[model samples]
Target: MSTVIAYVDGFNLYYGMRAKYGHRYYWLDLAALVRRVRPQDSLVGVRYFTAPVRGEPAAAANQSVYLDALAAHSPAEVETVLGRFAAKRLRCKTCRGPLTCACTPPVSHRTYEEKATDVAIGARLVEDSALRASDVALIVSADTDLVPAIEAAQRLDPARAIYMALPPGHMRPSRHFSTVGYFNINESALRACQLPALVKDAVSGAVYARPAKWH
Candidate 1:
């Protein structure tokens, strides 16, 4: 059996799912989803890279619960690696001022970028590929920034398979890079692989309820 290790871009998957299906399938089971998508391969692990939601208490609470649920999930070995959000000031091209200055169009506004996640994923992927930790590396994301890492991994292990996997509902493929292959997870998998409404933490035995808003 070919060993497969999945690297998931949590935000990318989240926004895409929200845009396409709303919160109906937010309580997802990462392992089962992977199994549904790659039934023939032996999955070894799943690395989930994400950041704590900021400026939204309800959203952050829900995300925390979901992360805990993933931690307690017995069927899959999932590791949650948190990155961070960095603020960057936006300025109008013409006025070079804040949005208040009022440009004709395309007003500037403060925005935050997710930091460290891509780098962490890239470094880990390259290391794992170089070490031959698994026979296949499954990267799930639409970000083109990952192109260089994927290419480097391929160069490191020419015989190993490196697949660029798009999460369910992602129609457009990243035009930046080529890999050994590309895979698209379907909506059925996302719908069918939801976690239980009440998940008990495997370590603390604390029960977490699904967010009311999610229902």
Candidate 2:
């Protein structure tokens, strides 16, 4: 039996799901979603990498509940790596007037944002590869930022198999690594992995949990 390790990019996947199927679907049981793609003889374990919500109290509380649910549901199968938040410089090009508009000055500002998670994920990939943890690596992300890590892993051990999982309806090839497989969680799969609607948080009261549905 081939062993597969899955690395999920939480933010990338969240936006992808939102882009494909409107706003209602947000809460997702990642472990359950991955199981839908598992082959009978494959699928050893899944590693989910995500950063916690930093500012908003309500949002943070809700996220805590969802994370708790994931842990409670699949204690053995799922492992989560928490990431940090960072400030990034944003360049905004403003447009003036209408169709025959002139380009305004580019504004640069720093905003506190979710930190790059690919670094942690990349480190884990290399670590696992060095230890010969699994037969294949399944990375659930479309961010090309992970190209170096993927290439390094292949260079280290030429036999390690690397695959990609694009979010539903979004497909793109990586600049560095050629994707072997592209797994998209469609509506049917989402339906199979959807979490319960009502979630209780320690800090907040009952919050509405909307799991991503298949579209």
Candidate 3:
């Protein structure tokens, strides 16, 4: 039996689900979702990597509840990686006209926040490889930032199998990175893992309808 381990890019998958099914489907059981994809006699463990909510007290509390539920269902199966939000500055080309226009910092700087998840993911991959814990690795992310880490893993174990699970709406692989094979999680899979109505948000009383089809 081949030992399989799954590595999920938290923000990539979360936004992907939101984009495909809207915020209503936010309550997802990731381990259950992956089990649907596992082949018999091949799965050994599943790993999920994601950062916690940065702001918004209500949203954070909701996320914490969901995380607890996930852990309760699969105590040893799920592994979470924490990432921090960092702010970045961007300059608008239109704001500064052509060469004649003087460029001055806007009265209010534009701040964009993003989660730092790549480094932590790469480190974990290396750690797993060192322990020889798995025979095959399944990476669920579309970010090319992981190219180097993937390559390193292959170098460490030439026969190691590597696969990718691209988020919905992704049609092409990154030019900088490619995988031996890829799987796209479509609407059907998303719907299959949709949370039930009872545990749905109690505040807004929102409930998600399952997708009509299954993948």
Candidate 4:
């Protein structure tokens, strides 16, 4: 039996699903989804990378519920790794332009940028390969930064197969990811692999319900 581990990029996967299919698939079962995607292999583990919402309280609550549900249901198969965001200031493009205008006023806004997710995924990918934890690494993302990690994993263990599973609606992957074989996630599979409306933690007896907005 071939051992397989899946690396999930939470932000990429969330945006892709919402953009392509809307919020219907937000309650996805990661292990079930991976099983549908790769039925031939034995799924050993799944690593999910994401960061908390900064300003949106409702969205943050929904995210917490979903993550808790995943943990409550598939505690043994899935692991959630959190990243952080850094706030940065951005100036208006009109303020700094080639053409000088009298009405060009200074405008700036603070925005948060996701940090450490790609690095975390890369580190896990390479580490797993080095440890021979799985015969195959199924990376679910379109991020270009992970290419070097995939390449390094292949170099570290020539026998381990690393494959890229692009999120929905992402047709073009970076040139760096071309060397690795790819697969496009289908909406039908996602539709079939959804978490239940309610889940309870066996140990703590804490219940997690699906968010109403996701309905």
The TM-score leader among the candidates is: 4
TM-score of each: 0.90, 0.77, 0.77, 0.92
Better of 1 and 3 by lDDT: 1
Error of 3 at 86 (Å): 2.2
Candidate 2 minimal-lDDT segment of 10 residues: 94-103
Better of 1 and 4 by TM-score: 4
Cα lDDT of model 1 by residue, 29-67, tens digit: 888787777888998999999999876788989999889
How many collisions between residues are there in candidate 1?
0
Tell me the whole-model lDDT of each prediction, alpha carbons only: 0.83, 0.72, 0.69, 0.90
* Candidate 3 per-residue lDDT over residues 1-215, each given as its tens digit: 77788888888887877777666556666766676666543666677777667555666666676665555555577776667766555555878632332446434344446666887777777677767778878888888888888888877776778778888767666876654577787667766775553344444554433333211
Candidate 1 overall lDDT versus native: 0.83
Clashes of each: 0, 1, 0, 0
User: Which 10 consecutive positions of candidate 1 have the poorest summed lDDT?
Assistant: 99-108
Q: Candidate 2 residues 15-113, lDDT tens each?
A: 887788765456676766766776642667788888888656776776676777666556677788899777655544574322322447534445558
Off by over 4 Å in 3: 88-112, 195-215
Q: After superposition, how far is residue 127 of candidate 4 from its true place, in Å?
A: 0.6
How do the residues 102-212 of candidate 4 rate in per-residue lDDT, one tens digit apiece?
554934456788999999999999999999999989999999999889989999888998888899988867788867888899889888999988899999999998888
Rate residue 77 of model 4 by lDDT: 98
In terms of lDDT, which candidate is stronger, 2 or 4?
4
Ranking the candidates on lDDT from highest down gives 4, 1, 2, 3
TM-score result, candidate 4? 0.92
